[model samples]
Target: MNQFNKTINRLGTYCTQWDFVKDRFGKDDVLPFTISDMDISTSPEILLALQKRVDHGIFGYTRWNHPDFKNAIISWYQKRFDCPIQDSWIAYTPSVIYGIVKVLSVYNPQKKPICFITPCYDGFMKILSSNDYPTKTVHQSLDNGVYNLDWNELETALSQSKVFLLCNPNNPNGYVWSVEDLTKIIELCKKHKVIIVSDDIHMDFVYKPALFTPIIKVAQKMDYLDNVVIITSSAKTFNLSSLGGAYIICPNITKLAEYVYLLGNKDSLSSAPALFITSLITGYTQSEAWTDELIEYCHQNLIFVKEYLEKHLPTLSVTIPEGTYFAWVDCSKLGIPMSEIQDKLLNIGKVAIMDGDRYEESAPFLRMIIACPRSKVEDGLKRLVKSLL
Candidate 1:
């Protein structure tokens, strides 16, 4: 009778996580747990809203300037995180990475290496590398599975860096940044005159006892309004990534202008997609309970991963995540080299999990995405253990 137990066939849907497994991992036959997007269904409410929009029959150029779009964003932050942002402060982007790259190009036109914590998102790493931007990382330390930043190292990196990039409730392993953590990061970045670029897309999936604090909320009181910016979307929150809607909240007037200019004039992506805007408003305004259920299901999936690995594959280790649906498993105990782990997994285990080094993590690990049905979670775990054997 569990609502989340329902399975949906995802293959033949051009799903990157399912159909493009061979394109990414060189193995088409394997079950994939590499991409961070969900395998679970989005809110039925959102699907219905999109259908209504489709039925309207006019797919003309859609503008996101309406009050509803901004109000939905404003109310979501206010209700969920107690954050209040001006409607005028919000601007649209095609995706989070699109916003980040625009900010980087405008803010750090010199392309100097930006700084962020280690075991970072592979997407960020790939983007930085693709732009030939040198990056400096201060590897996070662990205190009972919670990722802790080395403050001294962070300060040192910030002192020399132009930007401090963050994926709040960081990916790979889900470490929700406490308010204290956010405060300290803001203080260090402000002290060094560096900008904080945070990707807050995964904020909604945090479990209880661990709150997702947006860096913008923490910096709202500070004098450095121009130094903080966050790019996020309902895409990650509502399984609407394929729909293509993202936005930026910048307190800096000048940089915000530049971002809009880059997006509208330079990139010529002025019009927002109608379906994406509909999805955003509907998901934020109407589908909150759906999000709550999603959090519960994902948290349970992570716990299952931790316990299942401890029981069946003692050599593998996973700590239950505090946020997001990902389980970053430590496979160093298996004595498999980073280079050969995926080969073994694909050929032997018939599983496709991302290698930790792609995120520049120090030790050997595998990042498994578990935002799917319980059956897939169980089957994927069994496959992971088989790969190791």
Candidate 2:
């Protein structure tokens, strides 16, 4: 049997996806396809590693600067994305967003605003709003279903921005950025002298034939290495999010030291996670096959969603994402307002999925997390169809 075929229940586990569905959708009974985390179990090899750490039973204050763990990340990037980095470029943060926030702490947003292509991750919006940071929202041109960068607009935004916060394999839509796009973006940022802070947490989920061009590679190629900061986590790929580990890859030696000193001394969040480090060691060394199998499973899952939606609810379109195990579903063909659609999905269908509005999209779409067992995918699709019909 396929490993993905195995089922597990997360209810009563206090999982935000299951136990606290009401906190998001305001309905306790709805089946949630909302959170980005997978409902399926993670790699067995990773589980074993965590179990071994648990058996050791000495969970004291830990450090993250060992070469073994750093080399694990380096090797994975080299093998997976053909991206190379050294131990000096790595720094530890508890989460990707935390690393971004730390980077932001060093720059003044008032002089030049942060710029990013929208419909972007809502977390980006929240961070800007909370901090009162100036920002420029570059709108990507949506053609048929895919989103393409508007170079002229992007250039304009970059001119006035200090930083470009990039979401590779952009959330809510899973558009794996092409090499050309990465090159052009690096060129623009270089031209404007703007720093790029790339959050590539979804790099592993990129589908085949559509490559995930790590921005760091482009930066290195363009000799713009010092201006780029690569922030990513193993949490998403290994389902080790609850383990709380993330790292930053800053090639600028001076800035890398600054991040370590500040995030460690000032922020007090630079300590390593014992289990998270162990999982990375074992998962990276042992779970290559498991991850490959997962990618194939998720690729097929994305296909199944598109096919099922087409067959049952023709008007509801699912944009076949080039990466990530998410379905960017469009219900605009129904001509129903987004609010009404959201209401029906919650109140009537009892299917809780995230609305695109969360990602600041103008379209009435739902970003469904399809990285679960096939049964849940079908169940959510049926419920969604029931809502509209």
Candidate 3:
């Protein structure tokens, strides 16, 4: 009954999430459930807008401060997330990951190690190691399928570490940190002289009844705004990762501006696709109907996954995702080593899922991307369960 079905094509699209891992798994046909992006077709309005821009036939260089581009982003953030912003705080980067790297390079950590909560995104470790920065991880507790932050442990890490890289609505686990929790974390950081690096790229995909609270907002209220640096982008929400439009949100405008100038900023210019996405996101922000529907659909998908697991794979515990479309399934009951389970999934079931050990200390867990269509989710789950059996 959905009108969005016509544009959903698995062919001719060249999705790295699905295509790239096919041969690696030694599968003739891969049922990849690895990456986070949804298999569902993008919003028609977004595609049309991008197409129209392409039809214009002018592919000239564009600036990030273009009136429409800047206004679109500003208007969208204010309307969607209640993140009030000044024009001066917005600085463009090629990607959110790139912005994170800049924070590592610019911030003088001295002797203090950078701390991130463990069972985190695997790439963060790679980033830290690549930069040669020492990292200390605070492991979260596993309670009733939900991952809970050990506040005391977190504080201990923050006290010793200089930079705390926080993932809001945290990745792999999908636990949305409450405002009160964030306030406490900021207070601890303030007490410890810790600089906060908040990655809030998944802020927009939050399901209702659970809100995505920006750490910066809480930091600002606590007069700890100067200690915070936020990196976010519309790429994840708008399905425009290739567009390469992202911003670093920090209140110390003069510091960032001087830093950019010092670095001889070369790639700050936004592209045509970025402009198109900004325009598309502007409309989406103004009209919540699409996002509302999307959230509802995602929540239903989560419910479906939970119910499916309970009935078929009773031993596999899954945390009902508070935000984002990822379901972290605890696979300890199967008695197989994490590597063996991953191998079985790829070779036997033709399924490619993210291994648990990648998140650090989550060895018996399986991260499933539940962002695809319900039919695809069902197929993946069936294949996974069959592989386990």
In the range 245-336, model 2's lDDT, one tens digit per residue, is: 89999998988887888888887877788888898878777888999999999999999999998898999887788988789888888998
lDDT of 3 by residue, 326-348 (tens): 88888888887988888878777
Please state the error at residue 243 of candidate 2 in Å. Answer: 1.0
Candidate with more favorable, higher TM-score: 1 or 3: 1
RMSD of 3: 2.3
Clashes of each: 1, 0, 0
Worst 10 residues of 1 by lDDT: 141-150
Report every candidate's CA lDDT. Answer: 0.86, 0.86, 0.75
Candidate 3: residue 174 lDDT (0-100): 83
Which candidate gets the maximum TM-score versus the true structure? 2
